[model samples]
Target chain A: MSLDQNDIAKLARLARIRIEPESVADLQQRLGDILNMVDTMQAVDTTGVDPMANPYDAFQRLRADEVTETDQREKFQAIAPSTEDGLYLVPKVID
Target chain B: MPSYTVAEILQKLESRECSSEEITQSYLDAIAKQDGTINSYITVTAEQALAQARAADELRAKGDAPALCGLPIAHKDIFCTDGIRTSCASKMLDNFIAPYNATVVEKLAAAGVVTLGKTNLDEFAMGSSNETSFYGPVRNPWDINCVPGGSSGGSAAAVAAGLAPIATGTDTGGSIRQPAALCGLTGLKPSYGRVSRYGMIAFASSLDQGGPIARTAEDAAIMMQAMAGFDLRDSTSMDVPVPDYRAALNNDIKGKKIGVPKEYFSAGLHPDIAAAVQTALAEYQKLGAELVEISLPHTELAVPCYYVIAPAEASTNLSRYDGVRYGYRCEDPQDLDDLYTRTREEGFGEEVKRRIMVGTYALSAGFYDAYYRKAQQIRRLIRNDFVEAFKQVDFIAGPTAPNPAFALGEKANDPVTMYLEDIYTISVNLAGLPAISLPAGFSNGKPVSLQLIGRDFDEAGLLAAAHQYQQISDWHRQIAPHAV
Candidate 1:
């Protein structure tokens, strides 16, 4: 159940969060502790118990396909880190 | 004015004994003087609050005012406030001003409640103690060195210190109730979907629920009347009819069956908290309520189950905070991966990053069934325990937390130890049942709370039971020493 540096690195990559090399050991230790605590659930036999995702077992409520929202592109884009032509600007992915 | 509870202030407002502007000014003055030491508020909207109070006074003069009109309340920064900074006590959103009001804020404002300001919270509502907040830890009003339990610590501390009459708080696990318990205030976590989550920053979408923190159950009821309802904007918002919470506050609990879960009185619990809960149970018995010793066999698994599920959900919800659309961004990103990774790493606090990592790992490909699905299956078992207990009793009673507020840095280094603070309260959230924490007694001069868990959507009954107890007890009336 313990996480090593490689596992921590992989998790950070998957989660898209960078962990400094110095903090990785500490993270591994703390995350290992948390996982150890979470491992307690393994002791209970949950055979055939239906997984409950939502508390009420309520399904997603469908709404009609309608354009209810007013255009607030300018208002919203005003707060973005970077934007151009009402589209959010991010690091270029295209080669 | 500082000594009055929300209910008392409401009477004064309705009777015109004092003007709304005066009450708002008094709270503003108090916050100005006391909040420096307590660190309760992240932002204080003094000008806007006074403007809203004056508008409320104008409405009152015209003989048309909403039920909670003119009341000043603080909002947990997690709830977005239009044109105001809603930080969630994190550096990520420290510069982000919300474009729209959260449904709770909008609804409360519509009901004539003036906004005092947004209060501090654990970063992304991630920690048990307020120490995780980027704004700094909210000191317990009772003792300046201790923490006001979080992530609703600021809301609880603000209300407990009389900086605000009532404040809104969201409970993903025990954020609302634990802080309320520690601060010696009444905090309610209504049934899941009972309140709209629209615009409220999502920590764990399934578990996150907004409720009221106040000095008494009556005040909480009044706040709940303005808060609980269905909103078309939120997909999970319930369609059930909202009840008159205040009307049922005085209902007699004769022959009511309150189940005392044996597992809740385990060895991990503090002796003082156990004694306080026992005394409160005896008081309930004297009020003609019968106590039944019940068992929630899966109680021990709740913490583990919640840790897995909440983090998994939080990891997904927080992914939206990439450097693109809004919120904090890194200085120079050479590539897309660098942008996301550096932004998140630098923006989020240690606890938030820890949870995101835990959640990502739990939902990762190979470990999905072992962690995520297994936890969900156990979540069903934990919920079933409450369902069965409710069948045998009208409500479940226990101590809100294992212990009272500890020193600020006591559990900061220990994550698991901090996680256990919500052991008793998390199960109710997992089960999506309504629960309330009432100030039961004091332990070593710190506050201890008695929690009452009710059936789904039964907030009226839960508040009534809490209100009945408050009628006979003076614990909730004991203001923190700093406030006094």
Candidate 2:
């Protein structure tokens, strides 16, 4: 159940988060401990059981497609972290 | 007027006994005086509450008011409320203003419930103690030094302190129930899809559910009545007809079969909590409830299955917050990779990051089958255990938390013990059944709660059983002793 630094870093990448290098030893131990805690699932016998993906038990009703909310682009973009010319500006995705 | 449940408040507003502004101001004043020490609210929307209250009053004046008109409620920070800061207690979302109300928020507002404010919770609803909140941990009103059980700690604390008549809370694990128990209030987690999840910030979406926290089982029932309904926007929203929850409040539970999970009574259970559960069972016996000793052999596996399933889902659900769309973004990023990395690193808290790591690892390309899929298969097993137990009983009762309020930081470093804190409550979520927590009695001077879980979409039975217990006992009315 022990998590090495490399594994911890990989986990960070998965979560899309960053942990300080100094915080890794602690995170590793803690993650290992958490894995140990969640390890109880290993003992359960799930024979003949289907994974219950959702609690709902109905088919979705399709509706005629229609626009709902009227355009409020100005109001919507008012809260954007950064905006320019009605488009959200961000770091370049392509070089 | 101030102490009425959400139902009673609406009734009064409809009958013209009090204006919505008066009710809103009274609750706001109560919070202003009391919430300083409790630290329950992260954002107090006095202006919005008044505005909504005024609107509700106008509707009432015209005699065309909605059912929950003018009733104020606290929203969990996890829900995306329009124009309001919807930080899921993570630095990453601290600056993120929701472009729209969470579907639940929109629905509640449509019903005319006034917005009191947003309540505090574990940062991204990750930890058992509210200590992980970047905003700061909320204190248990009962004992300030004692930590309020989280991640819905603030919602529980607010209701307990009489800050709001009721507040909405989300439970990923036992977040709502455990806090309700520790804070001496009532909290319900409806069947997973019974309430819409459209705008709720995902945290183990399979396990995450939004419900009500209130001072009494009756109040919780009233709030749940409005909050539970079908929604087209939420793909997981149940198409089942919403029931008249208030009418079912007085339903007979005589001769009802109540299951006591033997595994829940095993070791690690605090002696004090054990006594409270025993007493609660005795009261249920007085109400003609037949207690059956049942076994959920896979009870221990719930934590693991949940961690695996929740994180896997959380991993996917949370992927949307990649500093790319709407929330926090890193400044002056060297490249896309750096932008994603720096933005995330700077935004999420330690616990949120840890879960992302675990979820990411489990759901990774190479390990998906062994970790994610296998865990899901086992989730079925954990649920089957409930199915087998429920076959012999209509509902199950157990200790909500192994012990009452623990000191802050007691288990902060020990995530295993912390996860185990949810042992009794997690299984219900895994099985997608409705569960409720109510104050059973006091143990070791701290309040304890009895957890009652029912079949899918069976909140009425859960509330009936909980309300039945509350009727015979005054535990729910007991206030935490030392407060500010």
Candidate 3:
């Protein structure tokens, strides 16, 4: 149940967070300690227990398909990191 | 004037003894004089507050004022306020201003409550101590050298110090109650779906629910009455009619049965805190309430279960914070991957990153069952314990936290030790029940708290029990020396 430096690096990549090589050892140790605490969950027998997703077993409420909110693209896009010609700007993906 | 509770302010406002502007200005003045050492506020909306207060005065002049009009309150920075910075105490969102108000914010604003400002919290509401806030740790008003239990520490501390009479706080796992206990305030964490979560920054979709923190349960009830209601914007919000929390306050608890969990008095609990809780329970007996010893068999499993579930949801919710969207962007990104990686690396605090990594590993392929799924299964068992207990008793009583305020850096070096600060409070969130932390008494000059748990959506019961306790005790009215 322990995580090593490599495991933390892989997890960082999956989670899209960068890890400095120096900090990787620290994160590995901390993550390992956390997992060890979480490992105690194994002692309880959950053989027939159903997994609870939401505390309230209620389903997501549905509404009729309709436009509720007015167009606020201009207002929303105002906060984007980079916006030009009504589009969000990001680094080039294709060559 | 700053020391007056919300109920007192309301009476004053109604009688025209003081204008909302005067009250709002006094609170603003108090913040200017006191918040330097407290660090409770991330942003103080002085101009907006005065403007709102003037509007409330106008409404009163026209004889159209609402119940909460002109009252000042501090909102946890986690709830978005239109055109105001809602950082959730994370550097990633430090520069971002919300385009819309959270449902709670909108509801309270519409009721004419003036927004004093946004209070600090753990970055992304991830930590048990205020030390995780990017703005810096909030000092406990009771003792400046000690930590205010968080992620609602700022709100709790501000209310305790009389910087504001009432403040809004959200609890995922003891974020509200733990801080409330440490700061000697009444903090209620309502049932899931009891309050709309729309525009409130999500830490865990299933667990996060906003509530009120104030000096008395009556004040907390008044704020909750304004804050709770249905919203189509939040799919999980319940459509049930909101209860008259204030009216329910005076209900008698004669012969009511209260469950006292034997597990809560475990060896790890501080002796002084345990004694304070015992004294409070005995007082409930003096009020003619009966106490029955009960056991929540799976109580020890709550921390492990919550850590898995909350962080798992956080990793997914925070995914939208890539440099492409509004927030802190890494300077000079080489590519999209670098943009996200470096941006997140530089933006989030250490505790946040630690949680993201833990959550990612738990939800990752080949380990989901062992961690996330098993934790959910254990969550059901933890919930079942409450269901069984509630069948025999009207309420569950225990210490809100294992200890009172600790020195700021005392447990900073160890994450596990810090996590245990929420030990007694987390199970309520796990069970999705309403709970309130009552300022019971002092231990070594710092405040201790007793918690009362209610059935789902039964905030009225919790508030009534707390209000009854406060009616007979003066602990909740104690003020820190600096605040005086």
Candidate 4:
């Protein structure tokens, strides 16, 4: 149930959140404590229990394919950090 | 006007004893005068609120305004408000202006309620204490040094401090109820799917439910009347008909069976809180409700299960906050990875980042079954315990929180201790039931609350019982000295 420095680094990479090298040990300790708390669930006998994902156990509702939203590109894009020609601007991915 | 309950305020408006503009102005004045030390509001839309209040007055003068017309309320910043900042008390969305109104805001507006402004909350609604807020911790109105439990802390504090008559709050793992308890107000977390979550920012999808925080259950019921219902925009919103919450407020609870779970009164519960809960139960007994001892044996695992499920969901839900679209973006990025990592790293707070990392690890390859799946399976068992208990009892009653509000920064460094602050209230969320936290009494000068959990979609019954309690008890009437 304990997380090491390496595990913390791996989790940070997977979650796409950078952790400063100095904070890694602190994160490892805290995350390890949280995991220890979560480890209590291991004592329970959930062998035959179905994992309850939703409170109501309801399935995702489906509607017929139809255009429901109006194009608000201009309105929506106005709030973006960087945009050009009605598209969000980000670093170039191409070689 | 600041001292009046929502019901009293509505009555005054109905009788023309006051104008909506006058009421709204008084509250705004109070906020300006009192909120500096309390720190409840994140954004106060004074100009917009007055304009809306004047329009409400104009409509009322014409004689066809909605029931709650002209009443002012605060929204927890987690709910999006078009043209207003919806920070969720995090730097991530601090600059993000919601392009459209949340369904809750829309519904309340349609009911003629004026928006006082957006209130503060724990960052991304992730923590038990409001201290996690990037803006700063919300000070408890009862004791300025203490926290008003969170992530709905600001809303609770606003109402308790008489800055607003009522406020909207979301309870994922006791956000609304815990703060209500600590701040001496009534807060309800309607059953899962009872309230639409359309534009209310998500923390844990399955458990997040928006409800009202008011000084009394009658006020909460009035607010809930406008809040609860079906919405097509939210797929999880129930298709059930919205009941007349106000009409059901006075229904007799004389023969109601209130289940008192032994697990709730464990050694960890403070003596003052336990005594207050017992005193409240005695009052319920005086009103002829029977207290039946019940057991929710899996109660011990609720916090553990919730920590896993909530963080797991948060990790996925927060993935949308990349640097591209809206919200906080990093200074410079060499590549796409840098853009994503640096944006999130700089945007989120410590607790939020911790949760994301924990969630990522839980949902990661090879560990999914051991952590996420196991937590979900235990979640089922925990829910089953409630289901069985409810079969024998009409409702469940206990302390809203283990103790009263702790001083700010006391538990900030220790996440687990803060997580345990919600131990008593999280199980209700796990079971997806409606529950209300009403001011029971004061514990060591801090407010204590008694929580009542009801069957799914039984908000009317829960509110009625809480309303009945408020009728005879004057605990809810005790105002914070700072507020006074």
For all the candidates, what are their Cα RMSDs to the real structure?
0.8, 2.2, 0.8, 0.8
**Residue B263: error of model 4 in Å?**
0.3
Assess the local accuracy of residue B275 in candidate 1 as a C-alpha lDDT between 0 and 100. Answer: 96
Residue B408 in candidate 4, Cα distance off native in Å: 1.0
Global lDDT of model 1 = 0.94
- Relative to the true structure, candidate 3 has a C-alpha RMSD (angstroms) of 0.8
Candidate 3 residue pairs in backbone clash? none
lDDT of each: 0.94, 0.83, 0.92, 0.93
**Native contacts present in each candidate (fraction):** 0.90, 0.65, 0.84, 0.88
TM-score of chain B of 1: 0.99
User: Per-residue alpha-carbon lDDT of model 3 for B1-484, expressed as tens digits?
Assistant: 8779999999999999999999999999999999999999999999999999999999999999988989999999999999998899999999998999999999998888999999988889888779989899999989999988999999998998889999999999999999999999999999999999999999999999999999999999999998998899999998878889999998999899999999999999999999899999999999999999999999999999998998898889888889786999989888888999999999999999888888888899999999999999999999999999999999999999999999998988799999999999999998899999989999989999999999988999889989999999999888887673
Share of reference contacts kept by candidate 2: 0.65
Which stretches of candidate 1 lie above 4 Å from their native place?
none
lDDT of 2 by residue, B275-319 (tens): 989988988898998999998987877788888888778778778
Error of 4 at B154 (Å): 0.4
By summed lDDT, which 10 consecutive residues of candidate 2 chain B come out lowest?
A: B475-484
- How far out, in Å, is residue B21 in model 1? 0.7
DockQ of candidate model 3? 0.86
Cα distance off (Å), candidate 1, residue B121: 0.5
- Which ranges of candidate 2 are over 4 A from the true structure? A43-49, A55-75, A93-95, B1-4, B7-17, B482-484
Q: How close is candidate 1 to the true structure, as a TM-score?
A: 0.99
Compared with the true structure, what per-residue lDDT tens digits does model 4 show for residues B299-357? 99999999899999999999999989999999989999999999999999999999988
